[model samples]
Structure formats: structure tokens, C-alpha cells
Target: MAQAAREPDFRTRLQEWIPKLVLSPSVAAMVVFVYGFIAFTVYLSFSDSRMLPSYDLVGFGNYAKLWGLSAWWTAIVNLGIFASLYIVTCTAIGLVLAIFLDQKIRGEGMLRPIYLYPMALSFIVTGTAWKWIMDPGIGIENSMHLWGWTSFEFDWIKDRNMAIYTVVIAAVWQTSGFVMAMFLAGLRGIDNEILKAAQIDGASSWSLYRRIVIPLLRPAFLSAFVILAHLAVKSYDLIVALTGGGPGRATELPATFMYSYTFTRNSMGIGAASAVIMLMTIAAIMTPYLYAELKEKT
Candidate 1:
């Protein structure tokens, strides 16, 4: 009878402590900082506000104006450019680097660190460096002339049509290292015996990679592709630092546009609409990848 009474006490104690155990302080922090912030942003989006939050509700006025803006259009166009360039350049360069580094290479340990070190730097630093290097009058081309490589002309930063490419280049310089690491990790997982068998079957190095190795790295490629795509979609910081949507708002992107509205223009309603659009765009692009990730997890 005493043992039976102890069981009830244990159950009662467990019930009382369950919430504490399940909802940790870290979890509570996520709720307050992440989920709570998302909720606040969403709530603000539905309201009519300027400079500060106003509870007076206005429906879709912000959305209409945001859609009508030419700066917004430029942002949409540049987003496409940024995504296309970043995905293609990063994947191609990263794959090449991974394959080269995978070879029985001299100084590979040092080389790998050299490639990956850029990832440790923030975009602010990267942007500053790139701005200097690509500066029309004072940068590489000017120095090249000093070195007698006078035929070279590297002046993309000042031209409106070409400034966006400079942004893409800066982004790739910073991010390709991360993709290289991902590809290198994938390469390590591949069996060397399979590669030897391919060589025994008279496959050239190019043929071996194209036919066997590339296909095997699909999961890694998919993962990296999604990551790069998400980064491209959300890109703003590097562009802001490098160009500031410059030369008549030529390099504008969605996030930057939202920022312009929210802070610079003090059009909070339009900014909120842009934010919602950004969320929707990301969701639309990610739905397929998200489904695959979920299915794989299960």
C-alpha cells in the first residue's frame, strides 16, 4: 500500500515538472526572439503605419502601391540577375575547386584554407575590398598598367549596366568557398574503389566525373543549390554595401527595396507589403525542396 502511494506521488511530480523539462530556456528564447518577432512583423503588415506602428487597419493599399513602384520593378529584375549569376558561378567554381583539391595535390592543406578563408569574413568587409579592387581609377587595372599589363581594362564598377555584375562577382568571391567545402565533404564520402573501377574500364578523368562522380554528388549538389538559391533570394547586404542600389537605383533588390521604404522613405505600409511578398516568393521557391527535405528526414 505504501509503494502504491509512492507511484501516485511520482506521477504527480512528473506532471508538475514536465513543462519545465520540455520548454527549456533556449526554446523560450526562440519563441520570444524568432517566433515572436515574426508575429509582430506580420501584425504590423496588416496595419496602416508611418514612422511607427499604428493600429488603424488598412487593407491591401500598401500592396497596390508597392506593386506600382518602378524601383520595385528594378529590384525584381536584379534579384533574377543575382540569383542566376550566384547559382551558376558558385556551383561551377565550387565543383572545379572540389575536384582539383580531391586530387593527390601538393600543398592541398594550405590551399583548402586559402579557398575557405573568405567565408569567415562578413559581407561588409568583402564589399569594402571588392569596391577597392573594382574601383575605376584606382584599382587593379590602374595597377596593371603600372606592372605593364596595359592591355587589361577592368572597369565594371562605374558602368550602370555592368555594376550589377560587380555585385555578383563580390558575392561569388565570398560564398564559393562555402560551396567548395560542401562539395569536398561530398567527394570524401565517395568510394575510391568505384573510381578505380571506372579507370579500369578505360574512362577518362572528364568522362569519369561526368558519368559517375557527378551523378553521385546529386544530394550534395541539391543541398548546396537550395542554400545558394535561398541566399540569392534574400540577397541585399552585399549589394547595399557595394553599390547601394546605385547609379539611379540600377542594382536594387527586394530586401533593399523593403529597407528603402521602411527606413529611408518612411513608407512602413509599403515596406510591410514588400516583406510579405518576399516571404511568399521564398515559400514558392522552397516548397519543392522543403518537401524533399521532409521526405528524406522521415
Candidate 2:
């Protein structure tokens, strides 16, 4: 009897230990690669490291210089514009698309995939394709001229002032479908009984959606905003492929700024400072949302 009890206890202990043993590698990787590197970056930001990392401390000198630079200011301003437009435009377009799809249209399956196909492509691919389409000499403008519409002028990619909006356009095209899918999932998860009750209370279609449906989609809206905001802040590949951060630094964002200073300009300390700032910005946006989400779940 004692031997049988010991065997069961051993099996139970083995089962518990197996899961942690399996998960240990991933946890260890996150600790070493993700959080470890983040801590190293923070340390380097205060050190006088350039061309290579050095341990010599410089207090806030790097940060002061970063703040005073015109290029850094331009990157920050550009980020504000791009992030704002990208989030708002994506949310609006996605909400509309989700609502349209939720109407149970005849070809819902086919149309859904078509809308989402752009998202299936990588940002690098999307940026390269858009670059060709937006190019003045060999793109839409050239095609239009060949087809006898000589007056058509779509040269925003080369225009300094309008170049950032071109980034916005490409980003929205790539991400809005994903946002739509988020909202669509939220819409689908909503209880049908509540919707029917609202309809039975003499609520017109517009009133039904406005009061009941849209209110219930608050989580989706918040999720979309958080995701798009993070994407906008870290956006490097799309800008690199599409604008290369300019006709003249017009589309430079924090990510590009960090890379330029670190590798190209040999200002590693400043670059690390910029990276730290970007991390803080993301944390500020995410912390409250995460806390609220956790609180609600608890």
C-alpha cells in the first residue's frame, strides 16, 4: 500500500516538474535576450559610448545633446504626425469595414480574404510595391500620361511636405484590414440576444448600432489603438523601404533616428538614449491599458 502511494506521488511530482522544465528555456531566453538587453541599453545610454560601447559614465550629456538636435526634433514631430494619422485612419476604416462585413453580405467569405490579403504580405514587400506605384517616373503618374491623361500628377513620394502622408497611406493600407479583423471578432463575440432585445425595443438600425453595438466594441477600439500606436512608434522597415527617411528627413521617425545615430553617425550613446525614450513612450501607453485589463479580468 505504501509503495502504491509513493508511486502516485512520484507521478504527480513528475507531471508538475515536466511543465516547468519544458517552459524553462523560453523563460530563460526572455530574461537573457529581451529584459537583459533592455537593461544593457539603459546602462549604455548614460555612458560615453560611440562607435563602440564604453563604460565611462557621462550622466545626462547624451540625452541633453539628443534633445537639442534639430534632426531629433524632426523625428519626434514626424512621429507625432504619423502616429496620430495612422491610428485614427486605421481605426475609422477598420470600424467601417467590420460593420459592413457584419451585415452578413452574400460573399462574406470571399470579400473578407480580399480585404485581408494586403496584411498577409510583409511590410517590406508592401513598402517596395507601394514605392514603385507611388514613383513619379514609372508608376501611376507615368501610366496615366501614357493613357492620355497628361494632367494627372501624383508625385507625393518625392515631395518633401507630402512624403510623410504617403507613409501614412501605405501603413493604413497594410494594417487597417487587421484592425477590421479585430473589431469583427469583437462584433462576433457580442451576444446576439442583447442585439435582438435592442431591436425589439423599436430601435432603428442606426440607433441600435449607435447605442448598443458600438458601446460594446470599446475593448476592440482600445486594443486597436494600443497596437497601432506601438507599430507607429517602431515603424522602421516601411519607412526605410518606402521613403528611406526622406526626400530630406521628412519621414524620419525615432526608430530611424536611433539607427542613424548609432551606426551611421557613430553616436551610440545618443542612439541608446533615443531607444530608451522610445521604450518609455511605449510603456507609458501600455502600462495603464494592461493594468486596467488585468484589473477587469481579476
Candidate 3:
């Protein structure tokens, strides 16, 4: 009898331990790779590191230099433009596509995948393709010239004044489908009875959507905003592939700024400072939303 009881207890403990054992490596990886590096970066930001990390503390000198740099300011300005346009454009396009798809359209199963296909490709791929498509000498402009529309000028990728908008365009193209999927899920989860009741109450389609349906998609909107904002903040690969932060740093973002300073410019301490600022910016946007979400769940 004691042996039988011991066997069951052992099995129960084994089941619990197995999951922890499976999860331990991932947890440790996060702790080390994510949190550990973050802490180390923070330390580097306050030190006098240059080209290589040094433990000598230099107070806030790096941050002061980072702020005073014209290139860093340019990156901040570009980020503002890119993030704002990226969020608004993606959200608007996604909402429209979701609403269109929600009409019980024929071939939705086929069409949804078509819309989402761009997201399957990495940002690097998207940017590289857009780079070719937007290049004045080889892309749309050249193609237009060949097609006998020589006046066509779509050289925004190489134009300093308009280069940042190109980044926004590529970002929106890649992410809007994902946002649409999120909103579509939200739309489908809405209570159909409420929609029917609203329809019966003589609500026009516009009024019904404005008053009831769109409001119900608040969670989806929040999620999309957070995700798009985060993507916009950390957008290095896309910019590298697309503009290489070129046209004289017109499309430079903070991520690129950090990389250039750390690896290329050999200003490691200032780069670390820029990285810390980027982290704080993301935390500022995320902390409140996460708190509210967790609070609601509890």
C-alpha cells in the first residue's frame, strides 16, 4: 500500500518537475540574454567606454553628448515622423480591411492569406524589395520612363526631404496585414446579437459601426498601437536594407543611431546612452498599458 502511494506521489512530482525542467533553459536564457545585457548596457551608458567597454564611471557625460549631437536629434525627429505615420496608416488600413473582410465576403479564406503574405517575409526582405521598387534609376521612375511617362518622379527613397516617408510606407505595407488580423479577430468576437439589435433599431451602417462596432474594437486598437509603436522604435534592419539611413541621415532612427555610434563611430558610451533612452521610451509606452491589461484580467 505504501509503495502504491509512493508511486502516485512520485508520478505527480515528476509531471510538475518535467515542465519546469523543460522551461528552465528558456527562463535562464531570458534572464541572461535579455535582462543581463540590459543591465550591462545601462552600466556602459554611464561609463567612459569608447570602442570598448570600460568600468570607469563618467556620470551623465555620455547622455549630455548624445543629446547635443545633431545626428541624434535627426534620428529622434525621424522616429517621430515614422512612428506617427506608421501607427496611423497601419491602423486605418487594417481597420478598413477588417471591416471589408467582416462582410462575409466570398473567398475570404483565400484572400486573408493573400493580405497576410507580406508579414511572413522579414522586414529586411520587405525593405530590400521596396528599395528596388523606389529607386529612381531602376525602380518605378525608370520603369515609368521606359513606359514613356518620362515625367514620373518617384525618387523619394533618395530624396532627403521625403526619404523618411518611404520608411513609413514600407513599414505600413508589412504590418497593416497583421493589424488587420488582430482587428478581424476582435470583430468576429463581437456579439452578433448586439449588431442585429442595432440594425433593427434603424441604425445606419455608418452609425452602427461608429457607435457600437468600432467602440467594441478598443482592445484591438490598443494592441495594434503598442505593437506598431514598438516596431517603429526598433526599426533598424528595415532602414538598413531600405535607405541605409542615407540621403545624409534623413531616415536615421535611434536604433540605427545606436548601431552607427557603437560599431562604426566607436562612441560606445554614447551609443549605450542612446540605447538606454530607447529602452525608456518603449517602457514609457508599455508600462501603463501592461499594468491596465493585467489589472483588468485580475
Best by lDDT: 2
What is the TM-score of each predicted model, taking all chains together?
A: 0.90, 0.93, 0.92
Model 3 deviation from native, Cα RMSD in Å: 2.2
- What are the lDDT figures for the candidates, one per model? 0.88, 0.96, 0.95
Candidate achieving the largest TM-score: 2
Better of 2 and 3 by TM-score: 2
Model 2 residue 58 CA deviation in Å: 0.5
Per-residue C-alpha lDDT of model 3 across residues 118-197, encoded as one tens digit per residue: 99998899999999999998999999999999898998988999999999999888989999999999999999999999
Span of ten consecutive residues with least summed lDDT in model 3: 150-159
Off by over 4 Å in 3: 1-23
Evaluated at residue 270, the lDDT of candidate 3 is 99
Candidate with the larger TM-score of 1 and 3: 3
Which pairs of residues collide in candidate 2?
A: none
Q: How much does each candidate deviate from the true structure in C-alpha RMSD?
A: 2.5, 2.0, 2.2
lDDT of 2: 0.96
Residue 130 of model 1 has an lDDT of 91
Going through the candidates in the order shown, the clash numbers are 0, 0, 0
